[model samples]
Target: MSARDSATVRIDASDTLRFNALMPGELQERARMRARPDFPWVARQAAITLSEAYRGNLLLTRLLNDRGRVALALLMLDMHFEQPDAPGLTTGRLKAEAVALDICSPGRVGAILAAFRLFGLVAPAPDLDGRRRRLVVTERLLAIHRERWRTILQSLALVLPEEGERGLHHIEDPAFLAAFVHALLEPMRAGWRPAFDVPAIAHFADRDGGMLIAFALFGTGPTGQPLSISQLARSFRISRSHVVGIVQNAAEAGLVRRVDEQGSRGPGVLPQPALTEALEAFVALVLVRQAVAVRRGLAAIGVA
Candidate 1:
């Protein structure tokens, strides 16, 4: 099998151990969902929702803004959900697991955790062992996760109403929340990058506010009309230079193009067709994955 096929298998495998043989069917579902006439709109709205979510929030933008930091944050929550006891959720263990999963460096993970604690997203858990400090997810953090999950489920509802509604119905249930988080984290733990099919997205997916910048610039459609640098920077809580750097990198990769010579002041940054298609595909795949995850979460809690 080709590497793409191999990645497909691994991604599907992460969903459910008993459902291994259903990999082929999952791929079919992904394709069918993508082929839908409304798929592009759904994808765009989802991406916009996710991207806009981080806008105007300084602490959130700093902690969970980029793809890597987002994964790191989710990993912390997933580990807590999977193992809430001592040794299960600690700074050392979280850092180690992050390194093992290639999510980020130990130092970065530690720094983020410090920020999380300072911001009240996480707090020290009571443990008998003094040598290792245990961490616990705060209501603040859980609320953030719930909001993010709700954004995803809302998008899923556009395509798969039944599954999406069911998920939203139990969004606050601890059991369902735990299972849902684990389902989402499993693929990441297994090294599944959402942009696997659209490699060009890595240019935007890696930087802080990169994908969000794309969403802001691209608007709700593929026009990719120009927007002001100051506006983009303020929206994502980044500097003008940062936004310009992301745009320049994307332009070099042919994922986007500048139509004017205005440079950082306010150039006509248009997203190329390739970038639009890639983002659409990535969004569709995310919806599919979340749909399956919702089912898994519902099943885990006997919700049917």
Candidate 2:
């Protein structure tokens, strides 16, 4: 099977597991709701991280997908935010959390857990049901987390140079740690839906490679700049032809248009005004909503 086909099939398998949701996506929706009162900080952290990545050129769908897979793996080891005062989180509960967060499926979650066991990132432990398997987070994964933290800090520096190194933390701060856990994942907001939503995508009907291609434009080719297919392919790690196809698709989809009398504008892929407007509007909405979530959540944490 083709790589794209294989990936789509895997996503389809996850969709099947999600069929049991209370109402199509009840688990994810309820998780967002439950999070509001109990874990507002988590939601806000996710929003901030996503916004930062979007406004900057550091994130892509491939990186976002990898982060989701890693998040599921870490959840298996209960390495989410590392708050000792809170109760322990089990693998089973984490699977439920994944569903509730609309991040992944129980099957995908189990696959990551099993992979971690094979990689020695976790060790098997005795369970109440002796035959059942349970795993603990190992030091190796902690080390990996440290490395990932440094990488994020570096990426932040590229875009948010003004912040310098002050925002970097030792993973002990709950808010800082929470941001790491959700560096690539975006929060699912209600009523703000658009046909082509998701800030990760410069423009798209849904999240896909096309979206990733669009995202690359920001990192490599900002608005009003002349972006060549070769430049986009090299920057995004995709083929030149593929980038051309995506540009054509985006143009056909009305996310982009041509300059110079609907003809070639010197081998450049121009971003449409509508897409820029849409993204700006989306970012504004996120900052506003996340501010509210943060303000209300602060009282609970005694951080007024």
Candidate 3:
């Protein structure tokens, strides 16, 4: 469904109301933004920005790519800001928070944090209370977060120039970044997903390396060559079978189709209209949500 088609497509009233509960008037805002005449081009530009940023940091990106890992990373930063003087990001606390968000299991949190430590994204902090290990968000982690935020703000800037530019300018300011993270996480804690409105790619967004695949597919225009399973697996550092499984499931869901049904043509997957529209709309909605967060962050620092 293209943005134009979204104008005519019937949205479930209940879903709109549910989303609106978290971000007031967000569903309507997303609809309006998506309905814009220039939205398609903006979405494409934003997709390129996102794709380049994702590819720029392959290892850390892979570690923090999925829905669960993303939530965990942001939650750690949020808690760290909330209590800079105290032990905020303990394994137990993080695990409980992850469980509350229903995005990951406690055991998974442990493994993710271990990977963070192993990758030098986080380090041990002094335990003020003499019990429970405390982890501090390292500068490496902060740099990764800043790059991610900057990439999103750059994409958002394409659609809403002033707000996005302002965010990009003040992103390095501790106050602005702290406020932005809080604003971004509040809705997420309430279970607002970036691709929630587009159900076709919801599963993709949730899985590890799944979203990268979706974005790569969306970047390939009608004339561009499709991505093969081997390409995706190598690019994302995931197993070949994993890519095959993801593509197979997406094909079953009508999100993608094999370029050549017969073995003679080769092994590449094409993004169907379902995927293109969903990915475009996903980009639009994310920019809309980020605009809201940017305003909140800007407002916190007394910026208009």
Candidate 4:
């Protein structure tokens, strides 16, 4: 890839949050202020925590239906204890408010509540009897979110585009992006494994991975089989160079092989059996990630 292409795939810390651009003077002042001796680490920590939570939530929403997305956001916003009147809203009241927001069915509320409790993301407040108490977010969950966001952002940065560049904006708000980063990084917490190969694919796809994968898998041949270079380019709406590059990469990875070369069109073939198996595995992985994100989003709302 050209440097422009590589730059197009880089992600930055700014991608994790949505804030107004800072004037040079203001930025310098803020940097100096952060160097102060008395600055509270807790505040900095909280900011990081919130940013990661927002990113995670965003990824979760992408995996869920509209109702699930709205429901999760409402629950998180409602559960935020920093608001002045937050102390007065009981769990039941919050649940009712979520319903009013048209986020979820009343019947599903308790299941969500139970799941959050089990995950220790939220705990019942002390006053209104445990069952009806306000929801309190746990610090551990915040830490988990932070780590997850870091991983996702790091991996995505390798594949996502740069600002003001020609590429898909996989994430908008920094907070939401951070959350997704967090979710993507979770498996790494235990230890490195082979499944982390998605990052490699992301790096390969860069800004066009989704479209590329879709075309490669579904739009290539007439009967849904692999196609020749020209056919792949036409079906995928990409340049022949790009198709050649992708195929070459797949071949290097042992994910595909040239099956025949007799036709005037050059070669005609299909994904190697190994490639097919790999694709199946990747699809399964994506599905699992989506499911996990949905569960996390629902849990955030206080649903199973």
Please tell me which predicted candidate would have the highest lDDT against the true structure: 3
Q: lDDT tens string, model 4, 1-304?
A: 3312332343345531221131123233333433445322322232233333333242331222122432343345334533444454455765675566444566656666566567676675566344455666566555544453344333322222231121112333334433343343343222322223333333233322222432254223225444677664554345667656666665665555655574767654455545444433343343334334433333444333
- Full-model lDDT for every candidate: 0.76, 0.45, 0.78, 0.41
Candidate 3 C-alpha lDDT tens digits along 149-232: 788888777668888899899988888877888887887786655555677766476666888888888877665677778777
After superposition, which runs of candidate 4 have C-alpha atoms over 4 Å from their true positions?
A: 1-225, 259-266
The 10 consecutive residues of candidate 1 with the worst lDDT sum are 1-10
- Residue 123 alpha-carbon offset, candidate 4, angstroms: 37
Model 2 Cα lDDT, one tens digit per residue, 1-304: 2222222222244443543331244344333443344233322233334333433232233332243554455454344454544433456866787787655778867776666667676676555665444556666766655554444444333333322143343344556445434432323212112222333233342323454444344333243666666655665455777666667756765666544332353466676655554444443333333333333334334453
- Rank candidates by TM-score, best first: 3, 1, 2, 4
Clash numbers, per candidate:
0, 2, 0, 18
Identify the runs in model 3 with alpha carbons over 4 angstroms from their true place. 1-18, 85-87, 261-265
Number of the predicted model whose TM-score against the real structure is largest = 3
What is the Cα-based lDDT of residue 258 in candidate 1? 71
What TM-score should be assigned to candidate 4? Answer: 0.35
lDDT, residue 147, model 4: 50
Q: TM-scores, in order shown?
A: 0.88, 0.48, 0.89, 0.35
- Model 4 worst lDDT run, 10 consecutive residues: 159-168
